[model samples]
Target: MTTNIDIIKSSGEKVKFSLKKLSASLRKSGADEQTINEIIEKVKEELYNGISTKEIYNRAFALLKKKGGYLASKYKLKKAIYELGPTGYPFERFISAILKYSGYDTQVGEIMQGECVRHEIDVVAEKNGETTLIECKFHTEQGRNCNVKIPLYIASRFKDVKAHWDSKQHETKLEAGWVVTNTRFTKDAIQYGNCIGLYLLSWDYPKDNGLRNRIDRLGLYPITVSTLLTNREKQFLLSRDVVLCRDLIDDLFFLDHLGISETRKSKIQNEIAMLCKH
Candidate 1:
């Protein structure tokens, strides 16, 4: 069998199937080495030229469910986030909730003045006098990277904000400028952010504090992860400002308001509770 096979990505581009990358993703989802190898073999056997990554992901997820349900659920996280929006607002709000859970008071879509210009920050996190200005880049499609230009543009904005506040008398103690995205960052983006002391958060970037790690740590799965909610249902919830799994836990009535059947509502609540359990 040929090792090279073209697979269509979510960005409508075709790329070579990567066994090592698949293994890495499974390992990150807490799969044991044996399971990872088994899944890889299964996926390799199923691969063909022009197969989509979505197809590969579904196959892997289904196999994971058979091997271990919890791992399968965990594996759904990145895709769940992608389901958060065609627009990034829902993602920003979701990130705000995560920060709030982590002890940072957060605000989404705050307008602030910089030294040189006015900037609309996505999420502002404040904890114990330390403030972090966050920019969220959300993509509904896979294989779309947060490229170097993003960090460059954001860094410039941060400098403006930092310089402005440093000259103000209101005692704003700014800690960092952060860029968080649901997708991966390009190599150049990571390198540029690190060189300038900018905080770059993306899916599986930093070993301990990547966006995925943070979500896992907080048990903050998005509402899109629930199998009870169909894609249209999830989109409806998103339209109504219901984004997080934790949101469902807090207000089961929200589900009821959406006209979800009582039986289905109970099932969804149980699923959300398990997935978002701290």
Candidate 2:
């Protein structure tokens, strides 16, 4: 089995190789190959020995984003990944996975009522016939603040629930709402969520053990094997490396090939191992 460090080195090499190939192709097409090559070299020089392939791509994309025109494709791919999901599941997968793991049946990417317009709910989890609307936030460390979105989601859910109630004759209604994030929510966001009866679920790395332990205790199983595999397939298409992408694709095809359950823990271990191997 390949070690994590090896994987990282290999992936970095592949990124350099791919950039060289792309530069040469662009040169042949009469594009500004020299500038592209310089950009690639600059990015490579700045990259550390153990940087993951994704980080390298992000750096290149950021550089391209600063430039104009055709380079926009590179930036678009990065933006797509950031906005879509870590694994290309539309960011909503995080919300859906948490709900599923918590034993709630969920519908992802659905539109719900706001005050006057329809806004998309990342995930809607139903348990014992009560529905909880969820919104997912996948942001960087600086973007972890959830105060604005939290209040907006709560207000939207209130409108949606009220509309649903008005449409029906039944009196008993569903319970609360939820906002899930890949980063920790602000203290005020958490307190406000509680005040409005909206459950907040955040998932970061093990560094935030308090929150992680609490979520684990909740025993949420929102992500299914099928959903994970689907996400893997989508992400693979956006990958620049054929070999590493194929490896990930194959791994998804036979998830138990490493003899681990297809749960969040196993997936995290596999991803970490893969990144480290690079």
After TM-score superposition, the amount by which residue 73's alpha carbon in candidate 2 deviates from its true location, in angstroms, is 31
Error of 1 at 242 (Å): 2.2
**Taking the candidates one at a time, how many backbone clashes does each contain?**
0, 19
Best by lDDT: 1
lDDT by residue for model 1 over 1-278, one digit each (tens)? 52589988887887888888888888867799999988888888888999998899999999988873457767888888988877899999888988888899899999989998999999999998888999998988787899999999999999999898888775458979999999989899999999999988888889778888898888888888766678888888888878788887777666777788889777777777777765
List, residue by residue over 46-154, the lDDT tens digit for candidate 2: 6554566556556665665455433333223223324344442445654455456568888877776554567777777788767776666666432335665666666
Give the range of the ten consecutive residues with the poorest summed lDDT in model 2: 219-228
After superposing candidate 2 on the true structure, give the runs of residues whose Cα lies further than 4 Å from its correct spot.
1-89, 113-115, 141-143, 169-172, 204-211, 214-234, 237-278
* Model 1 accuracy (lDDT, Cα): 0.85
Decoy 2 TM-score against native: 0.45
Consecutive 10-residue window with the lowest summed lDDT within model 1? 65-74
Write out the backbone clash pairs for model 1: none
TM-scores for all candidates: the values are: 0.86, 0.45
Model 1 error, position 278 (Å): 4.4
